[model samples]
Target: MIITTSTAGRCPTCGAATVSVDDAEPWCAGCEWNLDAYDRQRRAPEFGWAWVDRWSHRLGYRLTRRQFTHLAGRPLGTGGRSAAAMVTAGVSVLLIGAVLALAVTGVWLIVAFPFPNVAVLLGVALLGLAVALRPRFGRLDPELEVLSADRAPELFALVDEVAAAIGTPRPQVIGVNGDLNAYATAVGLRRRRVLCLGLPWWGALSPPERVALLGHELGHFGNGDPRRMVLTQPAFTMLGSAADLVRPVDTVAGGGIIEMIGEALGKAFQWMLSRLLFGVHLVLVAVALRDSQRAEYLADEMSARVAGIDAATSLLDTALGHESVALAVRREMRAGHGPGRWRSAVAESRAAAGGRLSLLRQLSVREESSLFSSHPPSGLRRRMLAERPRHDPLVVLTEERAARIDAELAKEYEQIRRAVAWSG
Candidate 1:
């Protein structure tokens, strides 16, 4: 049966009336089955400040952005640079102050105690425990194959060209090894940039769309989003440890009535402190998410400029089917296939899924739009791009250049495929 926007057939599993949400893919309303809704529900919060955290951030982000725009005499959607900076700075002050108060109190408890030696020992141990509880930001993925400009000049050259087109600095480090996703991360205290491209994702794209994809990533660099994360990221990490800071720590039972009462009071104080820290962390995260979404929109604008609106939008359209493409590749590999069939696998997957747009529409049905998401919904992005004014191309990719760049990365495709083999 021919399917139109409003006409969704009954569920195959359970024959019942189908319904669609937000013009997304249809599902059996009677059976309460919808693919997109299922995906959203899976990711949705079950309990504990999840809903509160997301909505708080949404509200805080909107309020801050609107106020900043008004004060700066800038149009809404111009950029989130100033507001994010302000929020980060303000949050840092509050966090620092809280840390200092805790430190001073800890010191006072040790020095003024009746048994100063025992108090000092306990205080030192507690300090050590707090430090130990801090989050480890070490390398989690050791399998990531790092690429250098010297080794992959063609890939690096493409990066440089895209950066130049978008007027941003090229990332210092490049890594290959992901399924169908590309991301940028800030490294070290200086926040040196590293760009990681997933080969399977890259291999599936046409030459022009590759430029669009790169442009979108480069746009994040231009937006200073990852770099700005340096402050808030660590603060959020420290806040995570605040729970341990205030946890009801039990001590030796034979300490006496005074010691027992002291322990009880201390436990209550720590609990209160933990709750306060949690509240602060939620507010900061919400504020950050607002700026994060703006960064995405700004990046999209940059992608449109560098790769043209059609290419930029099409890249997003293809991204919806990335998981499907990755799955197909994994299936082939398990059957003793090699890297040669990577592109063919992607093609077959897309064909079986009824093309990129159709797959995207299906995915969007369950892609519940949330402020907590770093990026805006794919459907909204498409609409935003369509409404944006057309501009001259910032970087134009000739067919030959695109093919040549692909040839350069051709050698690394096998390595990336093997690395991702275990990922799925």
Candidate 2:
């Protein structure tokens, strides 16, 4: 079965009817030929470390497997806030208290010394570091082409509709960038919702699929992850910064005995702090993994309800094909022809991927469904969608509306295309 240009065609392999959507090559429903065409490589994402990554892969598989099994049997619901959320809130409080304690200790040290001394100098350093490590209130990036409701009424309207459908408030801030991803987060002290759309992926999707993307992200508002919680989010950032500050610097040998001893002490202090931060980070992230993955499933289900199962499935498949998009951008950019041809180049790359896509997806499932991963494997996600009750798309994207939306985004897309192409 072979289908191209969103048209049905006969599958050469099994003579099965192949249906194509949104100009992508069709997969035969009968023989499942070209099913892997969305996946271009048989390689899974990695940490690029040999032994550590090997161990991580195993651990991630085990954790995801167990969690998936549980999710499969049980109903999918985030339910009320759990005790883990309370624990994370407690951690956030302790982190803030630690900063206050540091400030107090610094002041006490300076006052008790009452003269020029190492104690005074140490106090000053502590004060500076404590201030430096203060939790930063997140702000939307100024460099992004932020689109206000007036600037992109059509886009904002779509977001509003999706938000309403999903029972979440529309994001307070919306911006576009060149990455092959998108995210919705509650940012800042006020926890104002912010949504950022990555142009590469946006350009690749069909209209209903875009709805699915929005549904999946905005759905996070109702099914919150502890990491995204206002209190814990800042704590996570503060801990990461603290870890970076305490990370040891390499020392050259052949220094004086005193210097050597001082360096050793410094290294020991760094090692202790680093390990403490690592342990805390591990616990926080590990505890959140199950919930996070479950949230992904819930979000996907929401997406299907609003965007239809087929559209959501297509979106997931395209997500798995981002490597194809990335590769195409790189290939065309290097040849000095990618500035405006990125979308076409991506189409070519996907076509070239052909049979390898399925294998790539299979390999990626392990990586994508890992304990450390933010989401479950696309394969499992699609399977879950298929097993669930089907729903008609609530918001239909007519060709005319899609065209209008594209027209509105034309300027931004032009600039974004060049940026993504050249940056590749």
Could you estimate the TM-score for every candidate? 0.72, 0.76
lDDT (0-100) at residue 360 of candidate 1? 54
Q: Candidate 1 lDDT, tens digit per residue, 336-396? A: 5554465568666666656336435434534535544567667556656777777766777
Give one digit per residue, the lDDT tens place, for model 2 in 125-148. 888888977877677777667788
Provide the RMSD of all predictions against the true structure, rounded to 1 decimal. Answer: 6.8, 7.8
Q: Provide backbone clash counts, one per model.
A: 3, 6
State how far residue 250 of model 2 sits from its true place (Å). 5.4
Best-performing candidate as measured by lDDT: 2
Model 2: residue 117 alpha-carbon error in angstroms: 8.0
